[model samples]
Target chain A: MRGAVIYAPGDVRFENLDDPKIINPTDAIIRTVATCVCGSDLWPYRGAEPIGDPHPMGHEYVGVVEEVGSEVANVRPGQFVVGSFATSDNSCANCLNGWQSSCLHREFMSTCQADYVRIPNAHGTLVATDEHPDAELVPSLLAVSDVMGTGWYAAVAAEVKPGSTAVVVGDGAVGLCGVIAAKELGAERIITMSRHESRQKLAREFGATDIIAERGDAGVARVKDLTGGIGADSVLECVGTSEAMRQALHSARPGGNVGFVGVPHEVAIDGEELFFSHVGLRGGPAPVRRHLPDLIDRVLTGRINPGKVFDLTLPLDQVAEGYRAMDERRAVKALLKP
Target chain B: MRGAVIYAPGDVRFENLDDPKIINPTDAIIRTVATCVCGSDLWPYRGAEPIGDPHPMGHEYVGVVEEVGSEVANVRPGQFVVGSFATSDNSCANCLNGWQSSCLHREFMSTCQADYVRIPNAHGTLVATDEHPDAELVPSLLAVSDVMGTGWYAAVAAEVKPGSTAVVVGDGAVGLCGVIAAKELGAERIITMSRHESRQKLAREFGATDIIAERGDAGVARVKDLTGGIGADSVLECVGTSEAMRQALHSARPGGNVGFVGVPHEVAIDGEELFFSHVGLRGGPAPVRRHLPDLIDRVLTGRINPGKVFDLTLPLDQVAEGYRAMDERRAVKALLKP
Candidate 1:
């Protein structure tokens, strides 16, 4: 098997690696059908996330189960499935509360950007499709494993409602998917902040009613200006940076909601500002698993095409270039076929 | 007329002041029937909130309308009424969205511990009762002016629902009132954090099913211990300190909600912790006016006795003693008669 490894910042290699095998009674061995480079991957690739040693890459994938341990019951060999980036037992109180990412027996699914992967807690983490998906539907199905579900969580956390004006604070793949989620959730006016032409086009296609090229305070001002100086009713914070979080907070009306799904880095919120903002703030590592069932249904029924976010696809051997394309902003998302 | 002034920390003076007159077309003059010293007032009295000049004190009051500006319509002269500490026009987008504290035309009702006070935005701020209230009903109705309404907002914002386990983080007047609000909102289990015997007694009377004397991490740990290690379903944060906020966040189950009505001082939230907690945080100055009508009804109908939070009563001339009693923790609250 061949997998991608990051030895250092700007250092990625694709080389032969040992295949994964089910070690736990509840685990499943899956032969990767498709995987992708995540926007979060850029954090470690660019050295923004500390990396002391070479590490396995990728946490997002849709695959066919090749084998399952004795305790695996929900999924079987040869079944195609999509799972959340974070694996969970799914029976814990947190999981029962729809916060699977915080489940008691949670584990990170890493190195899935390879030929084979071992998924722990298979019965709880993997959502099996009725059958192997059509070749063209694979990418969209793969998105349900992470990005699409994350976007959907963002919309739901922001409480997007039938007539809400939602503002999305990023133009990355997740942000574009958020536009789709907000639209599906019945948001009437979707405003996306995007400075890139291609990304803006994708955002609009995904149901963004307006686009603002501005950043920082100006971007927030633009949102307020568009919403009659009261800010949007719901703001989806898809970027994790402090500035992005600030913008998201400032871009909401006094009693609006800011659903922040970005993996925050070096973000500090002033109590005074948040107190006065009167905006409901909720986010974290998205409980993507919570939205998987519905998103999978929507995808299989041809209701949404989130797969369009994967503008770049490469063979597993060229995973290095997949990382490069996304790191350089040449692709919104990179789909890798193993 | 007479009012209380804070010339400096620990310096409160009750002295003669000019009678208030309706200056704005939207203003109304009200003769104070009852005013109270708030937990928030201790901030200035303790020198936590700087006082640069001899500023008027008191912001919570229930009064009888003495005169109404020509444009005022919702309230009229001689009517017994209650208004939020923060007066709002109630016509702004924020107010319409249920965040009256952030209304475009918001004015803090200072000099309220006086014989008469001019209320701005009276038409939108004041809610008049059907008739003059009996002496016994006056205290409870006065609570609807601020503390009770704030507690109700905390419960509502925290999304306390039927069968939910709710936790109140402080045992001050507002926190005790939160227990009552949580019960009224259909919370099945109410846990209030209190170390003082008197406050704990009041907490129980207000519907606290359990009381935790621990503070900070221990309190949070106790809550998790009580809820099968998952924490409370909803947490009402009535103390504004960083420690209290942190505890409130930690005390809630993942995906739980925290309604914080504390006037924060020196509180800074770490974005990473909040994001990972998966706790919904919504707070600020309570939009008390939003809950006034319903709270007033409950008070007038004797459904709740939030006024019991005021353990001491003093004449307007003893306003300094009222502040001293609350600041010294000798009283949970102090009601001033003008």
Candidate 2:
């Protein structure tokens, strides 16, 4: 099997690797039908995050089961399936509480950018479609494994409601998807912060009623101006930076919510400031496993087309170029076909 | 008029002060019926907060309306009233959104320990009782102005639901009141953290089903053990220190909520740690104004008796003793009488 491996900053290589095997009775091996480079992948690729010993990368996938361990019954050989970046047992206390990302026996997937990937807790994580849908629906289904699911979580966390105003910070793939989620969730007004023209266009297409190109204080001002001098009812922070967090917080009305999905870097929030803001905050790895079934249905029913986030596509062997294009802002997201 | 003035740390003195007068059309002058020393007062008394110059202190009171400005209509002269520490124009956007503490024209009361006090935004801030209540209910009515209202806000913010588990951090008046709130909100189990035997007894009386005297990590461990290893569904943080914030955050299960009411001193939360915890956090000065009528009704109906938190009573002129007892932890709270 071939997969993308990070050796150092800006040093991703496509290399042949030993195929993954089931290591637990709860595991299953899936032959990747579609995979993608995540914005989070850039953390290590750009040297923003430390890259220790070389390792396989990727956590999003829509694949077909090649084999299943004895205990895996929910998903079996030859079934097309979608799974979350974070695998869960589906029956743990946390999972029962709808926080599957925090399942006690959770394991995050990180080798899906290969021909074959071993999925832990497969019996609980993988949700097989009734039948393989049209080939064009694959990208959206793949997105449900992570970004689309994450975007949905952000909206849910922000408590977006019908007739309410929403602000989405970050123009990344997830943010664009968040615009879609907010719209689907009935947000009357969707405001997205984006400076990139292409991303802004997509955000608008996805139902962003307004766009603020400014960052930081200016961005907050624009949001407040649109939200009647207070702020939006919900702010989805799709970028994981201190500045983005600040903008999200400042863009929410008192008693409103800020749902942050981006993996925070060195962000430190002052308790006093947050306290005074009267904003509700909830963020984490999206409990994608909990929402996978519904999101998959949404995709299949043609209610939402999250596949539009993937502006560039590549053959799995050229995953390095996929990383480069996204890193350089040449593509919002790059879909890789194995 | 007489009032308590803080000339410096540990130096609260009873002094003759000018009688408060209506300075705004919406203002009302209330004759103090009952005012109490708060745990927050201990912050400045213990030199934890700066005291710039001698200033009138206290922000809790149940009083009789002595006079009202021309524009004041909700409550008339001689009417008994319950008011919040933070006054708000109820018609403001934030107030309409159920966040009166964050109202656009909010003013915090600070001279309520005096014989008379002027209330700004009186039309929206004061909730007048139908008639003067029995003497037995006066203390409880006073509690509704701040502590009880705050505790209710904490429970409401934490989203305490029927059959859920709730944890109250801090054993002060607000925390004890929080136990009452959780119970009223239908929490099946209420765990209160308290080292003081007296407070523990009071908490148990206030519907705290469990008491964990342990602090820090040990306390969190005990909470986890009692909550099936996941922590409580909701945690009400009634103390404002960094330690209290940490305990509150750690005591809530993933996807659980922490409603913090304490005015944080100097706390900083690491964004990454909070993100991974998957806990919802919302904290602020309680929107007591929003719940005043309901809380007053509860107090009058004998559904709750938060006034029991006041273990010491003193004449209004002996306000210095009120501060001293609370500062030394000799009393859970001190009630001041005019």
Candidate 3:
């Protein structure tokens, strides 16, 4: 099978690799239907996060269960499924609490870029559809693996309610999906800060009532203006930059919530500012498995088509090209079919 | 009028000062019945916080309204009243939202250590008992002025749900009151870290079921052990130290709430630690005015007695002695009577 591998920083390669097999009874072999590059993947591809060795790449995929271990009681072979970015044991206390991303027995599915991959804790990790849908729904189902679930988690974490105003900080795939999530959660006014036309257009299509192209103070001021000077009731920070985090902080009302899903990169939280602001900060690694089921259902029902985020597509053998397009800012996200 | 003023570090003096007079239509002048030195006040007296000039001290007091301005419709002259540390216009949106401390018209009553003090936004700040009780209830009413309200805010902020375990990180009066607040809020188990026998006794009396003498890691471990290694559902950091904050973080279960009421002093927050721990930090200056009514009712009904924290007592002329005792740690808190 051909798979993507990260040998070192800025060195993502596609080459023939050994096919994965079910190594544990709780694991299932998934034949990848579609896989994609993540913004977080750019962290290492751009040499921001250190890459140690020729590691297996990709964690987002919509696949068919080619084989299931004896212990996997919920999902069976030949079933179309959308698994979370991370595999989780359904019985763990954390998983039971609906935070499967931090399940006690969890493993990252980094090797999903290959044609076939072993999914540990398969019973809990994958959410299968009632029946197989056409190929058009593959990209949207693929999104269920990470970005869609994450964006949904951002909305849930922010406590976005009916008649609420929400500000989405990033215009990337997750932010676009977050706009959709907030709208689904009944937020009255959804504002996305975007300088990109493609993401902006998709965001508007996903129920964004307002868009502010300005950054920093102007962005915060525009959000405040949209919220009648009280700022948004909920602010979602999807970009992991100090300035972006600050803008998110300044974009929320005094009693509002800020759900920051962006991986904090050298972020400094000033205690005095947080104290005086009286805002709540919540959200970490999203509980993607918790949302995968509903998100996949939403995709199948034509409620939302998150696959619009994939601006480019390539065969699995050209995974490196997909990464290059994203790294060079040519695509919002690149989809790879295996 | 006699007042306690901080001229410099370790130099709190009792001296004559001009009596306060009503300035605003919503203002009232109160002759203090009883006032207490707070844990935060010692920071300035101990040279921890800057003592700029000879500043009038105290933010906690129970008094008689000697004069009421024209717009003071709710409160009248010659009434015994318990007022919060913060004075707020009850009509503002923020105040109506139960965050009076952040009200549009809010004034902190730091100059209330004097014999006569001006109370702003009298309609919102002062709450009176149905009838003036005996001398014993005066102490309880004094508690409602600040400490009790702060403790209740900490409990509310931490979200001490019923059947949940709560860990408090300080042994001061506020922490002791936090134990009481947690119990009133339906917390089943209260674990408090106390090295002092006096405060420990008060905490136990206030409903602390467990006490851990360990400081940071060990204290958190003890709490985890007590909670079957799951940590507490809620944690209250009342000691404004980075160590206490860290301990609070380590003591909470993942996705637990942390209500920090300690006035932060040069504390740096680590984003990674907070993010990985999944602890929600929420707090600020207690919305004392918002809780003053219920706290006063509780005190009057003999539901909670926060005045147990007042270990030392002094006359108005001996205001300096009250500061000295509290600053030297000879008293958990000092109560001064005019």
Residue pairs with backbone atoms closer than 3 Å in model 3 (clashes): none
Per-candidate TM-score against the hidden true structure: 0.99, 1.00, 0.96
DockQ of 1: 0.87
Tell me which residue pairs clash in candidate 2.
none
lDDT (tens digit, per residue) of candidate 3 on B34-103:
9989988988888898888788999998888899989888877778988888888877767776778877
Candidate 1 residue lDDT tens string, A1-338:
88999898888899889888878999999999999999999998998999888888999999999999999999999899999899999999999998999999999888898999999989899989998989999999998888888898899899999999999999998999999999999999999999999999999999999999999998988998999899999999998999999999999999999999989999998987899899999998888788888899999999999999999999998999999999989898999998
Runs off by more than 4 Å, candidate 2: none
Interface RMSD of 3: 1.5
Per-residue error (Å), model 1, residue B332 = 0.8
The interface root-mean-square deviation of each model, in the order shown, is 0.8, 0.5, 1.5
Error of 2 at A264 (Å): 0.6
Q: Cα lDDT for residue A78, model 1?
A: 89
* Highest-DockQ candidate: 2
Best lDDT among the predictions, by candidate number: 2
Flag the better candidate by TM-score, 1 or 3: 1
DockQ of each: 0.87, 0.94, 0.57
